[model samples]
Target: MKLRALLLGILLTSPVATYGAGGNSVVTVNPPIPAPDWTLPAIQNAKGNLSMSDFRGKITYVDFWASWCGPCRLSLPALNALNSQFADDPVQFLAISIDVVEEDAWDFLKRYSVDYPVVIDTEGDIARTFAVDGMPSGYLLDGQGRVREIHIGFKRGDELKLAESIKRLLSDLVTSEVDET
Candidate 1:
């Protein structure tokens, strides 16, 4: 399609690099980029909408995925575990699904268990805003909402890096709080 071709052209021209074993993510944005702020409605018209500013004091992980994306299948489960691991910490995990069909997303959720918040971006605005180059792209933001790392794809052991990033952010927050006190 024309859109896919355009996206490919953009990726080819950008600083994007692909490196992953076993055909796993293949895309990585080095030197982590700063994430843009945005708000989106909940997946099912559920309670409160998701706003980037709401999690300013917490380590935030934002995942951009689609229901039909193969990598998302693997990414979701790993993300679920990471979300659970930080349940009591000052960490927030959010998923932005680019699925055109709401039902498809709902169906996929039934197959996978996710404990964090999920928002549906039918127009793909959030993904475009983040310049997602792959299906399972993720942005790890520090407490101040600056992107600390950009993960372009998913693979086993990926959660370790994410966990470590969260730990670092939490540690930094504690240090700052103590200094203030």
Candidate 2:
């Protein structure tokens, strides 16, 4: 279809940075690429600005959400629970909102209180950088700052799968650290 062609054109034309042993060259992006760096203000904390690099040594679950996305209503609270579960572990959860009207997001937060840290991204630059094409997209980053998984949408049973992925990544981190030592 025309829509498919348009998307294909965009993908084929997209600029992808490539690294070489001797120098550098531009190449098409492959999967599991390094996530783009971004810094945003804390939406509900006194922590000031939070940069992606700050989570270098931790497993980061970056959830991109919006007030209008119904799945986010469920996803955020669930993420809070996951955050608590991983409280003692080296894991971090960042709920970044793309709500154009930040007041709306604030109101939603008022109704649904969460314990996890939140970042207000009204400009959506971070979401664009992540190429988030759906509501409630989640990016799982390993300790070394590589994108391990890109999850889209949310449903009733996705929680366990996410938790499993987190556990696997945590184990992988431990193994890698031991090997390095």
Candidate 3:
């Protein structure tokens, strides 16, 4: 209860910019912060384990979701579409399921198809590490692995705004690489 209240207050007070007229606001972190590195057992689209560092030097979008989350129903499919859109680009999408019961997550995934890698955080360790304040929380990390944007809730058409942000970040990354060259 206290955590929920604190999260609500933070969301309300955070400096979030609304994208488009959909009222979908993304919390852009000024001076992007380093994302906490993690390694988890991959459940879909791969074998063994995956680590955040393995995708370094690419735009990584870390999304925290669960089967019980209502917003995830919309977010999972939408995020999958976004993943496809950037398939040819230097971007990686990771979905972390915070379901205590592993079978629950599997059942949900059976219904909604997610093409990208999905990992299960059955013990909630990863969620606690990421400080997930809300369901379907998305962290957009730049190529350097710094979290550039944070989306707490999933609303209709939120993916469009997220796409725009990704494009802007990718552009910046490309320009920086060119400058270095």
Candidate 4:
């Protein structure tokens, strides 16, 4: 209960910029501070290579998952949907597998056909760097490579909320750019 209250307080009190007509406001919650630079192994896609630095100047969704986890499997479709929804945008959806071996993760990807980049963290180093304690943990990073939101566990409608959050962040970035110009 105490942790929940603290989280809620942070969400409510964080700095936000309001936009849109009729005074409709969108809250822009800040991401948590990241640890010092650390390298983690990534499998890249079947045909291409991807690195964490490649997503610079774009909002990135880093999801840590495993093949055998039920919630992880459940979140796959939603993650796929999110990838499709933001297909034309600068936002990226990166699903990193924490499975013990690359074979299992590759097999699962082959069966699912997720359109986004799926990286294999065969040694679980990436998961440890992200402090992931659950199978379906997620971290949202802004264009500047700062962690925006960290989510754990799976719940219904989480994908929708995540998509909305991305949209809000994108909009905020655009608005900030306009103000600067």
Q: Each candidate: what lDDT?
A: 0.77, 0.75, 0.83, 0.70
Misplaced by over 4 Å in model 3 are 1-13, 17-25
2 or 3: which has the higher lDDT?
Answer: 3
Could you give candidate 2's per-residue lDDT for residues 62-114 as a string of tens digits?
88888888888788888888889999999999888898888988888897668
Model 1: lowest-lDDT 10 consecutive positions: 24-33
Candidate 4's displacement at residue 114, Å, is: 0.7
RMSD of each: 4.7, 9.5, 3.7, 7.6
| Candidate 2 clashes between residue pairs 3 or more apart in a chain or in different chains | none
Q: Distance (Å) between predicted and true CA of 58, model 4?
A: 0.7
Q: After superposition, how far is residue 83 of candidate 4 from its true place, in Å?
A: 0.9
**36 Cα displacement, candidate 4 (Å):** 5.8
Per-candidate TM vs. native? 0.82, 0.81, 0.89, 0.77
Which residue pairs does candidate 4 place in steric collision?
31-147, 31-148
Off by over 4 Å in 2: 1-31
Give the alpha carbon lDDT tens digit for every residue of 41-154 in model 3: 988887889888988899999999999999899999999999999999999999999999888999999999799999888998767766687788888999888878778788
> lDDT for model 3, on a 0 to 1 scale?
0.83
Residue-level lDDT of model 4, residues 78-165, one tens digit each, is 8899988998888988888888878888777776657777877777766766666566777788887777776666655778778988
Choose 1 or 2, whichever is better by lDDT: 1
Each prediction's number of clashing residue pairs:
0, 0, 0, 2
| Model 1: CA > 4 A from native | 1-18, 23-34, 44-46
The candidate, 1 or 4, that scores higher on TM-score is 1
Residue-level lDDT for 100 in candidate 2: 85
Residue 101 C-alpha lDDT in model 3 = 89
